[model samples]
Target chain A: MSEEKKIIICRCNDVTLEEIEALIDQGITDIETIKRLLRIGMGPCQGRTCLPMVISIIARKTGKSPDEIKLPATRIPVRPVPAGVLVGEIDEE
Target chain B: MKNRAEVIVIGGGSTGTSIAYHLAKLGVDVVLVEKGYLGSGSTFRCATGIRQQFTDEANIKLMRYNVERWKKLSEELEYDVNFKQTGYLFLATTEEEVEAFKENIKLHNKFGVPTRLITPEEAKEIVPPLNADEFLAGQWNPTDGKANPFKTVFAFARKAKELGAEIYEYTEITGIIVENKEIKGVKTNRGTIKADVVVNAANAWAPILNEMAGLDREFIPIKPFKHQLVKTEPLKEGQIEPLVCPPAWNDSYVLQDGEDGGVLCGTGLEYGPTYDMTPTYEFLREVLKWATRIIPALKYAHIIRQWAGFYAKTPDSNPAIGKINYIDGFYIAAGFSGHGFMMAPGVGEAMAELIVKGKSHVPLDWEWYDPHRFERGELRSTAFQIG
Candidate 1:
C-alpha cells in the first residue's frame, strides 16, 4: 500500500503524514529533533493545530499509546506577535 | 549496543558526533553515548554561523582548517548538510573595532583565510536589506558562512554509524569507571561499556562528567553560560546569504539563512554562567531592537519561537582539548565557549589524530588545547566572539 497521500499533519510547517512516517522509519523517535528536522510544531500556530496528530503518528510508529507521548514545550507569546511591536516600533500599515 | 569498545565518546552534539566519526574513520572501535536524542544539546541550539574570522593566530589557524573541512563536508559525509559559503560580514562600529579588523585581517591572511576590511557601502552590496548607516566600517570574509547545525551533526552521526561506530542516544552516562587514574569505561543507564579511552565531549555537562572521573574544576575549569536566539518565518532562499553582525562592542547578529530562508537573529541576555533555558520576553525585545536596526525589514517578520542553550565556557573562552595530564586515558574537547559548532570539524580531526598516532598533524592542533593549562594559570587569548 505505497500510496502517496496528501494528508497534512503539521499545517504550520506543511508537514505531512508521509513525511513524519519517513523520519520514524529512520529511527528518529525523539520529538525535539523531529521538530528541529521537519520544522513541525514550530510555526505560528505552535503545534495547536498539528501536535496531537504528530504525536499520534510517532506513538503509532514507536508502539506507544498516544497519551504516552509528551507534547513539545510551548514557547512564549502563545499567539504570534510581530517582532517590531515588542521593541515599540508599531507598523502603521 | 556492545558491552565494551576500544573508545567511549560521551555526548552526541556536533563535537561528540564529529569526534565519533573521525575516530571511527581512523579505524577505532568507538561507542558514543548521549543523554538525550542526537543533536538535542547546544548543537541544535547554535546560531549556525561558521567562520574563520578570529582575533588570534591559534584560533585563526584552527578555523582555517575548519572552514576547509566545512566546504567539502557534504560530499565527505555523503549527506547534504546545507553548507553555504555566503560569507560573513562584521559591522565595525567603533574606531577600536576598525583597527582590530586590520590586524585580524592580516592574521587571517597569514593563515590563508581571505578576510578584508570593507566600507559600509561595500557591506550593503553583499546584504541588500542591511541598514548600513549604523556602523562605521566592515570586515568581510567570503569563506565564512552558515550550515544547518542539526544536518551537519546528523551527517557525522549517520556516517559514523555507517562506518561501524555504535551511537547510543538517550543513554545517560551515570559514572566514569576510573581505576588508578586511568579511564576504564563508563557506567551508563543501559549498563557498563568498557573502553581504554574515554572522551568527555559532554559540552555543558563536561564538568559533571569530569567530576565523576575525579578531575575537578581545579583540574579543568569549565562553566555553562546560557544564551538565547530567535528565528522568524522563512522568506526566500538566498535573500540574506551573508551573516551580518556588529563588532566586538555589541552582541547581536542577523542572518537570512537560519532555516532555509528564515531570517535568524540572536543576542546574549543579561546573564552570567548559568544553565537556564528560559526564553524571556525581555530578550526578545533586546534581540529584536538590534536585529531590526540592522535590517529594518525584519520588524515585519514574526518570530516562530525563541529557544535557549548553554555555551560551555572556559575561563579564556577556548576549548579544553587533548589528553588530560591529570588522568591517564581521559581526553576532553569541551568548553568551546560559543564557537564549538563551527570548530567541531577541526577539533574532531585533530583529536582523532592525537588519539590514534599520539600526536596531531594539524596546525594549532590538539596539544595546544591543553585541558590542565588553566590549572597552571596559562590562559589563552579569548577568540573573537559575536552572536
Candidate 2:
C-alpha cells in the first residue's frame, strides 16, 4: 500500500481512494455523509462516475455487502441542462 | 450506546450538532441522535449564504454573532470549514426597496454591523455582471459570509464527539418519554436513551417530536415551507463573490459557491407548509428566469442539479431557541424558516449558554426566541423578508 501511487476515486471532484478509505475507517459507512464531507459525488457528473467504485470500496472496507449499502437518490435533470434553456427560451407560437 | 446522558439533542443538522458541541464544550454530557446522515437535511440542501443585512435589529444582532462564530469555527474545530466572508449584497430595485434598505442599514449599523447603502454601480462592481439598470441601490455588509454547510455541521459533531458526546446517526427517535411534564428520555429505533433534558432541534420535523412530548396543537404551530435552489455546472470563481439578492423580484438571488464555482441561485421562499422535497420544473424555470435577470451573462451557464428543502418556519421566520415554559426539561432550537444554516453557530452557543449558565453573552432579546412567545401573539416579522 505504501509503494502504491495515490489513486483518485471520484474524477469530477478529484477525491481519492485513500480519502474515502480513511473516512470509512473512521466509521463513516454512509456514502451520502462521505459525499458531503469530501464533495465527491456532487460534481458535474453527479456521482454517476464515482458512486459505484466508492460503494464497492465502502462495502469491502466496512464488511457490508453491496446490497446493504445505501445509495444516494439520483436527482432530476439526469443529463446536465443549460440554465438559459430552462428559462422558457423555447418560444411556443 | 449510552443509556443515560445529561442532554439529548434530536436531529443532527447544523443547529443540533453545534448545540451538542457547545454543550459538550461546557462540560455537559450530550447525546445527539439523527434519523439520517448528519447534515443531510435542510443543512445540506439550503443555499450557502450567511448575511446580517436584515430589517429587524434582533435578527441583525443574532446574525452578527453567527457570522463571528462562523469566522472562528474552522480554527475552533481544527478543521477547514471553508469559511469565507465575501459579503452579501441585498439589491434595491424599487424606490420602496431603497427606502426600506436605508432603514435596515441604519439598524444594522447600530449593532456595530458595518452595512452600507451603495450605488448600483458599486453593486455591479461587486458582482460585475449584475443588471445595473434594475437596482437603484444595494446594502453591502462586509462581515456577512458563508461557510461549508456540510463541513460546519460535521465539524461540530466530530468535536462534540471528541469531547465525550455520543453521536448516533441512523438512530430515529420513535417517541419521547415524558413523566409528570418532565422529559424522562427518548425512545429510539435502536433503544432508549435516558436524558433529563431533551432538545427538539429537529428543524422541519420538530413539530412531530413536540407533539410526542405532549405539546398541544396550539403550541406546535411550527410548519415546513418548501424552498428550492439550482446549481449550475462550475462557473468561474470571482465573477460573483457576494450573494446578490433582489428582494424586489420575488426575493430572487444568485451567488457563486466557492466549493466548485457552481453558481447557486434561488427563486425564493414558497408559501406552503410543505413536506414535499421533489424538485419542481416550475421552480427551476423560475430560478433560471430571475437569476439570469440578475446577471444576464448567466444565461449560457449549464445547470448541474436542482433540489428542494424546507424552511421549518415558525409563526415568525425566527426560531424558538430556549426552554419550553410548560415542560421542565424540554427545549427548542429549531424553526429557522430559511436561515437555519447561517444561524446554527449562534443558536448552539446561545442554547448551550441558556442551558448551562442561565444566560448568553450574545446580545438578543431572549424573549423574542422563546418557545412560548407564540401564545402572547408576539409574532414579529422576520427581517428583510420580501413576502
Give lDDT per model, in order. Answer: 0.84, 0.85
For candidate 1, give the docking quality class from DockQ. medium
iRMSD for each candidate structure, in the order shown: 1.5, 1.4
Please identify model 2 stretches exceeding 4 Å from their true place: A1-4, A90-93, B269-271
Estimate, for each residue in B216-315, the C-alpha lDDT of model 1 and write its tens digit: 7557778887788888876777667888888553578888765658887887564657777888778898899988988998888887778888888888
Which DockQ value does candidate 1 get? 0.70
Q: Candidate 2's residue-wise lDDT over A1-93, tens digit each?
A: 853426888888888888888898898878888988888778889888899999999889888899987788777778788777777664222
In terms of lDDT, the poorest run of 10 residues in model 1 chain B is: B360-369
Model 1 TM-score (2 dp)? 0.95
| RMSD of every prediction | 1.9, 2.1
lDDT top scorer: 2
Candidate 1 ranges beyond 4 A from true positions: A1-4, A91-93
Which residue pairs in candidate 1 collide?
none
Model 2 chain B: ten consecutive residues of lowest lDDT: B378-387
